[model samples]
Target: MTGSSVLSVLCIYVVLTFGSFITVIKSLETQTQSHEHYSYDRVINLPGQPLTPSVSQFSGYITVNKDHGRALFYWFFEAQSHPSKKPLLLWLNGGPGCSSIGYGAAVELGPLKVNKNGGLNFNPHSWNKEANLLFVESPVGVGFSYTNTSSDLDILDDQFVAEDTYNFLVNWLQRYSQWSSHDFYISGESYAGHYVPQLAELIHNRNKDISENPFINLKGFIVGNPETDDSYDYRGILEYAWSHSVIPDEVYDTAKNVCNFENNNWSKECNAAMEIVFDKYKEIDIYNIYAPICLINTTSSVVGSDSHVSSFKRPIRIPAGYDPCYTPYVQEYFNRTDVKKAFHANTSIDYKVCSDHVFNLYNYTISSILPIYTELIKSGLKIWIYSGDADGRVPVIGSRYCIEALGLPLKSPWRSWFHNQQVGGRIVEYEGLTMVTVRGAGHLVPLNKPSEALSLIHSFLSGQPLPKDR
Candidate 1:
């Protein structure tokens, strides 16, 4: 054991030890990555079920850029039957914070299931019956969508949402190679007026940039009772209530005089007018006049006695100590052993149902997108805006005001249209765009009137002129 030999042997041992450690680390890393990438224990698979229109339902997550860290958004993809080259419809639900999975899944598009207690029956109006529908829980903190770092909680603007959504779409397309060439249309309601338009613009911008994949095709957008122009929406609500006799003429006049409909500022006079309007309408509850009845909670005297089944739909209930609109139940449902396994989310990080403390402001503005809509028109993308007539929040009048403000040329006069002889809805087609009013429907148009909504979507996707009346 000479000194040089002893040193050489020590170096060899150290190298061997480091090499072995590296091998173990790599193995662990590979296993973890595989779990993250290929894990599918959360998604519920309804194999051979006639409920789904397609043979396969794919669920996965896409990594989008978060302000604080990386964010993951869960998406469910339903393929079209027979595999034609059809456009993809991306559905979003509006809440300044709400889960697309909760509303868009349970209420609108995907197959529905009643609660264990048999509260509601399964609905046959799922949008998946028509087109390939992809519902995404957006931003870092919405729905089951979440981010890894604390800074992700700060996103409350259009820019952050659009960026994250764009990233998610791009990455998601790569994950599901079949959809790479599909034309994408963004659709949503309420706050989605903000989400869908901005997202469409971002996709359009990305498509034009030579550096990015030009193949990411963004076609058009549809918003149902969207909160696009707040001024128009609020003012239109008063007008709609007045026209429908929901509010007295005197009250409407008072509100009109005090409220500045053109300005975005909410004044004390406007607040007073709103109070008066609320007082007037408090006695009369009008939501769905032709929908199913919902069970009323024991706390309120207002039992579900309306003839309309859609009116008085129950506000979603969650377990105690959670926000029903955006909370743990939604995330938990999506992360169900069946749901997780089907969606492959169980293998990644634990799902966060709704982003806790994600957004600070309830309202957001996207001044950038108005011009983008014009650009889209110039580029020949057919745009459509539809409002459910019975909705007070974002009424038909508001949509009309917004479209009028755009100064679009009307190709045809506004008139009633019919799906059969039943008078399906109303339509106002102008140039390449169409504005529709869903009859006997409320804010959640698809939930309240799924057939009408689906028909409108089908018409829009086909690039045919919107029918005059339904």
Candidate 2:
């Protein structure tokens, strides 16, 4: 062979050998990752759950306060499809004490639905369709979340709740750092009106102080049927009851006139009027005025509790609709030993849907989250306030009143938004804020109107307007 030809052959051999060396290193690295992917958080299989090969599920604790041994339980479901492309969303349930896993995840928007038979079924409208969903049993003593220091239960307040939640998010990001860059949003309903906004403020404020470690990618928040202002909320409820003929004109007038509706303190007259309102509310589901109140004794066998059976005389019922009593079934499902073990939950503590201790002892530091909302909105966070129109608890009227109080310039006037070629809800947009009312939905909008709820959420995460036509 010629010398030049020999050199060319040597060059070809060197190129091939170097390429093979790089490939081998990459292959070994991939193998190392495959072996090291082991996670204490990895879920093997859930008892009684059907095989879901495509989706990933994780559950366990993130110790937020090590000194107090404070840990929060979390259940996360990767998006049903294209999880990598989806946003990460953390959902909270309000009661200032409700289990997000039990109420928000299982019953409302999670992939699992607690059936009347105490079995699990797929929620066809689960929010995982749009985002990677995480549900935490927040604050100490709620669901599987607990604090070794039992006194942590007694002193729980908005500040503590917000701080703990913020810590959970930050530490959670550290553990699941792959999602640190994903567009993130915090969401909840009811008293989470307090929880969600307060936590968002903390995250936002912390993000601003970049001198300190910041939650750099914190995006925005969405709250539904939130308990924002005691006064506006109460006034809205009274007005809603009268407008819907849920209460008589005289009862409504008394509530409107006698109640301060602007502060936490209530006069005797206000208390009396509220009593009349409560008496009337007993006949129907207060959460969803139009929803069928659960009168069935489904819990006799599984739950072994007669407390769930309503004593109210059955009003003429709608046969085919959302069951207002759906929540009790969820409580029973969570209480099951197998279910708790499968989720890596606190097997020792009996899970209650809403912790009575949390409700009673929880010091509500603020009657209105309006100030927080005002400051956050000014910061240009994507703040969306949505309400289930049929919810009497924190009715649409009240949410609108709170938004109007923000005094933002209107970006979009109130108009009906469509889904599946039908009017799903009405929405109004303002600079850095949007107010929405889901048609026919109750306090739990996703539970009442799942399809519309999914659309609303998909749009929010996509930063697009909700579908306006079929």
Candidate 3:
């Protein structure tokens, strides 16, 4: 061959050789990662926890922003059985600033929960039975998650929260490579109405690039008693209070007329009228209107504190179990030095179920999540919004209004769902969304009615319908 022809042949050979070499290296990397697990974050036992061999637990941090020294903490539980076959569900608790570990894992639906003596007890109805549970303390300042940059807390808002949570998931999946291919779902209650859908939207947008490795298989999201729209939520709170006999008709009427909930301009009369609502909720638990207020617990106030009222419409109240002491028990348990050591939390950091500081500073930018819901419905992701009929804060009345505003065609008419041979609650299906209610349950369904809530989630994840016949 001539000199030019020989040169071209050599160039092609060099390119082919490099390509094969890179492919071999990639194969080796995949094999190595597929077998990799972070043993350091594994939890063999908690300080006062019982020995339950049904599941594996791990707790640790994932740095979302290295430049800011920002990290998010997580408590992950493998499925009760055959974890590999189960879907992965990440649970968040809304406070704009609450510890998912405290509210979600320890108090509500984790395999273990805080008992009266600051010890742990096995919860048979834990949601881990249906999915691999991942509980995250998000947005830097809640629980063990932290940021070295002081100013980071000043700008906490919907956008800031979504980005951090998305980054954590991306990094977390890389570390837990075995779960990278599993179906994923997001769940939470209260302020998470904003968090859950926004994060789902982020995943939906980023996942459009099908070529990306470790693709997030976000199948759907479910939120309980979420804060969807300002006007509807405000209106719901008033109407629910009046309907439930939590407030007098005059107070509700005064606020309804004077409050410009859409514009968020609470005039002096509006403020005074709304203050009566808060003041009345203080008489009983706002989140759980039927539940009595706690007069015995001196170590704690409410679940989310008064900060919740100003930022997110209302606080978590007494966790909906009617015990009023559950929050105090869990609060005391998580703050223990040994318990902190066991959960991979910062021993020096005092873990609050909800942080007053984060709530105070959180820039409440997003007033409504319906737009994102509208967009995600088009993406064909399974979306379910559930309500505890007894939830005074995000009442069923408001949820109905919010759902109605979506303007989706009705897929199923309102009907009673059966569990334990009796009516569990009412359920209705919209074109791409589903709404469920747990009868007599309060703000936190898992805390109030674990069996029904578990059944609700099982139906949601498995693509099955709530049984009308037992």
Among all candidates shown, the one with the greatest TM-score:
3
TM-score of each: 0.76, 0.86, 0.93
Residue 367 CA error for candidate 3 (Å)?
0.6
Stretches of candidate 2 off by over 4 Å are 1-38, 297-321
CA RMSD of each candidate after superposition: 9.5, 8.7, 2.5
* lDDT, candidate 2, 1-470, per-residue tens: 99999999999999999999999998778656534432667667665555653457788888899999999999898898888888899999877667888778878899877787878777789999999999998888888899999898888999999999988888777667677789899999888888999998998888877788655576899999888887787788788888989999888877788877675666777777776776676677777778766677642111211211221111111111267566667777888898877777778888887676776667767778899988998888898989888877678998888888888899988888998888998989999899888999988888889998998998888888986665
Estimate every model's Cα lDDT from 0 to 1. Answer: 0.63, 0.79, 0.85
| Highest-lDDT candidate | 3
Ranking of candidates on TM-score, top first: 3, 2, 1
Score candidate 2 by TM-score against the native.
Answer: 0.86
Q: For residues 1-470, could you state the per-residue lDDT of candidate 3 as single tens digits?
A: 99999999999999999999999999878667544546778887887777655459998889899999999999999999889999999999887677788888988899998899878889988999999999999878998899999999999999999999999999999888889899999999988888999999999998988687347999999999998998898889889988888789899888888888777655677767877876677677777777766777353334444543444344343344556667778778888888888777888888777777887778777788999999999999999999999888889999999999999999999999989998899999999999999998888889888899899989998888889887
Candidate numbers sorted by lDDT from highest down: 3, 2, 1
Task: Say which prediction, candidate 1 or candidate 3, comes out ahead on TM-score.
Answer: 3
Candidate 1, residue 358: the lDDT equals: 50
Q: Cα lDDT for residue 428, model 2?
A: 91
